[model samples]
Target: MAMIEISGLLLLLLTIFLAGGVWIAISLMACGWVAMQFVAGGIPAGAVLATTIWGNSASWTLAALPLFIWMGEILYRTKLSEEMFRGLAPWLNWLPGRLMHVNVLACGIFGSVSGSSAATCATVAKIALPELKKRGYDEKLALGSLAGAGTLGILIPPSITMVVYAVAANVSIIQIFLAGFLPGLLVMVLYSGYIIVWHMLNPDKSPPPEPAMPFRQKLKESAQLIPCMLLIALVFLSLLLGWATATECAAWGVLGSFGIAWWSGTLTKEAFWQSVMGTTRITCMIMLILAGASFMSTSMAYTGIPLALAAWVDSLHLSPYALIAALTVMYIVLGTALDGISMIVLTTAIVIPMIKSAGFDLVWFGIFLVLIVEMAEVSPPVGFNLFVLQTMSGKDSNTVALAALPFFFLLVAAVAIITIFPQIVMILPEMAFPPQ
Candidate 1:
């Protein structure tokens, strides 16, 4: 069979399974089974499936996922979001956007710890929306900024999405983490810059400025943030400075999160068990997806699908930029229906080879992939962040999605900026681990 035919067949099977409401991991596994049974003769599909799952599951580096997730889960149950708002509001009121910047800053901070976009969106929005409403901020802008900035959960260091991408792409988890740092900050700047520009143009939309705070008062107000800041510093610096592996840092982050939660007096027995249960559920889901994806990748390798697809793409004689443009569009379409991790796992097997053939660095492409996935988080229908904000604000999905539209474009702008200046994604990684 032709590669295109096989590709079409697999795609059809996947669509059928998913549209039939099969779980994503099972759908992926089913697709792999069909591919191996009919497309790749004599491959011993059952043995391959068992071994592939075991190998993917037993990965030492993959251990970081659950620990980081548990860390986020622990912090999620704390009063951190309320404290964060109190601490950050005084500092941000002087900005043109005033307290609206809290959504962006708070999401970035909380995301560093949480690593889950929905959790970050939900956690920050829980505190930010009511406060923004009380302060007479524009509802659309408050919702929009929170929806947009909430994606920082995946872009910042200790991102769950980054871990899945790095493991799938067979790259350094730390390098991918480092690579994401600047791009994440770039998105924050873009979101905040948009807020500032919007406020300046429509000054009446912002509430009257609060009274100025004395420096000591400002410092005192921000004191609650020290533990969170220290936790971020410890995990990030350990990764950047080579003091620990990603998994080690995650373990330390988990310990640090427990300490912070205890200090905040929110680490009750119930909260601890809830955090553990949340981590278990999330980790099990992700690992199942990873296992299924690994098997499918192996099956595709046996059938030569990825290489053939790469060759077909190569035959198009498209420029590197053109290929990237095509991929960006493809991912955007995928984002409307799939969550971020699903988008990454389903495509990376086929996409990474094409990327390497185009002479693009995998680490850079991982960051690019993440930025595109971030855009997906705000997209309608299946956009998780949109759903999060809608639930919090008691708005319909359309209103929440419309509010997020500008940030969606900002994410597009972010993608373009990184594509044009690839150095932004590469600088930190290169600085931390220069090529020999």
Candidate 2:
């Protein structure tokens, strides 16, 4: 009952702070301070806060975050998406949805290198939207597909969200990265399949199929895609093949992205400065949130809140799937208010113990967590991708949300598939880093 009251007080304070438009990181810190001083009591809150923030902020695994962000920033300024469109258009032209597949393919490819959902959505849409519209493609399908496929950024690795989960849950970032691969591909295939089915059902919505391009000509057009593909292969394979750590591969990614930008004649001084600034701003935001959440996590521990809650939850003897279903509902509600990272950081304190008690693998749960966040990315109220699409398409959030509805359900379907077949999320990691 005391724990219930403490939880209620903290939740009420957090809701008030967030609703009042406080920055999430600061709101989290304030909540942690309140918990420390009132709920936990007796600890030197200042000392614990300072040390915990510093330790988490200085994490070597986290060094990869900014580097990966910088790489995405550089590519975002380049014509990579344009090149990918040109390369992919001819190959997919005869397929049921024709060039619409480019949105999914390009997002999947870009997401591999970018590791950010918003960046992937914005970057691909910047080029694909105008081009697809020009070719008389269906606006709703293009928009929805880009929005859905963009989530590949977090699921395919070098992912910032994966890094945060790794740090919070104390798992191998590499293993998490590896685990995400097959599932990411699964989502892509599911998305593409949906597009094919949609076009088949409503053939007139898509532009009429064009004549098949000469095989050799298709190959030539695809040459425009070589540099970006090579960079992705370099970054991804290096990590997968054990040639480098996640941080080191990220560094290589940055260098390779810069080289590609320069080689493509798009790396201007202005663009360089912009990429640096973008990386700094995003990195700082994530770091502050990480620091604040660290402090809060520590405070929660000192208060015995998480352990008590876990004990209570365990006593109920809910099955593993039941616990996951409950968490899914909780996270979706939280998603309407908080972004994915904040949700992960704030809940890890309570969720981890329940997960362990249910005998689920944390790494697999990390993938599960990411897919749910991907769902949240398209969800309304605070969905980041919805906001992004609204700005680009000039549609109201509701309209954009409606267009994204199919893909949203598709993401939910992905979660269910992975839940029933956990190996889909586990196979690559086990093969890559087999149990010793």
Candidate 3:
């Protein structure tokens, strides 16, 4: 009877999601309330609901999101993207994919310092897209590459998503970072592989420069990129070596990014003001969604919906693999309607507990979850990356959407590697973590 009721409640929730005329949080709350009516006889909905909603919102770790976002905004508004590319272009500029390679690599480097994927996509695209188009590169490659590569921002260290995951699951954030490194590199290499292989197969599609620069010139040009690399290292140490909390580490990155610009004579008062304004705007948007998600998750727990669903799933006795597979599919679906951060909030809250209850390592599972969430950020039907790419380039949105398909598959494979080989995700953190 519990199984039958759980099935009925799941269907009702699905109907609310698919009903098409309401906000997701509203729908979630409505469905959750309905579940309460069916499943819980004793609790007061309003009291339980308020407590659940406000409970997680009060976590101090959430402060990192807005701070990290502000850091990325400062970088973007200060034209760090321009500096990043100008610095790296010399070394990578002669390759077949040429500037596209620099674009991807620059985003990858920026990813090390900034934890916001949309900001990485928007900031990189805003600076690089026009220049790539001018150099006669394929629009598909230009936009698709930016959108896909930007996904790395969250998977690499200084990742806001990982911090939230650590807070949510009570795991070490350092462990999350160490585990994230290999998969992040794996994704980068795969993206580079796509660029190289795609150009190799279709030379016409990815044009080369008329006169490639000499190796020495390229080497000299790359000298400019060294400062940015140093910035990445300093920020990484602050957070990873226990010198700073994620928020303080992000503060260091924000100051350092601005300091470099000022010292280099690129950061003017005008630029600084613009950076602060942009940071304020973007940070507010993120925090609002996070707050709403907190409330909605609260409602779900208060309403007894999670308990109802968990009880139903437990009775099934399904293999862990099957359960995980279903959850991934649901994430892909939710990805269409939700931004990566919001998706993580809603899904991870509901699902992570279930996976842990089923005996999966939260550490390993967190890596898998983060990578998958990154993939959703770049996917179509609501991919924030796609919109950012389109807005930056003012070109074919459809083409960018289609081009991102290959990288999406690459993400699937990466998730599979982490899923099947939990050691791949755990080894670094296990080795790097200070004895606690």
List clashing residue pairs in candidate 1: none
Which stretches of model 3 miss by more than 4 angstroms?
A: 1-55, 93-96, 209-216, 295-299, 302-304, 434-436
The lDDT for every candidate, in the order shown, is 0.93, 0.89, 0.73
Number of the top candidate by lDDT?
A: 1
lDDT by residue for model 3 (1-436), tens: 5545664665567456756766555655565565555555565666765776677567666667666766666666667677778777767755667677877788888888777788788777877877887778887777778888998888888787887677656677667777888888888888888888888788887655657678887667667577778888887776556788766777777788878787667778888787678767765655554554555565556555566567667778878888888888888887876667667766655676578767887878888888878878877777888888777667676777887888888889887777787777777777766346
Candidate 2 lDDT by residue in tens digits, 87-192: 8878877678877788898898889888899999988888888988888988888889988988888999879999999998889999999999999999999999
Tens-digit lDDT track for model 1 on 1-436? Answer: 7999989989998999999999999999999998899988888999999999998889999999999999999999876767877899898877898888989999999999999999999999999888889989999999999899999999998999999999999999999999999999999999999999999999988898888999899999999899999999999999999999999999999999999988888889998999999999999999999999999999999989999999999999999999999999999999999999999999999999899999999999999999999999999899999998888899999899999999999999999999999999999999999988
- Compare the candidates by TM-score and give the number of the best one: 1
Candidate order by TM-score, decreasing, is: 1, 2, 3
The full ranking of all candidates by lDDT, starting with the best, is 1, 2, 3
Shift in Å, residue 172, candidate 1: 0.7
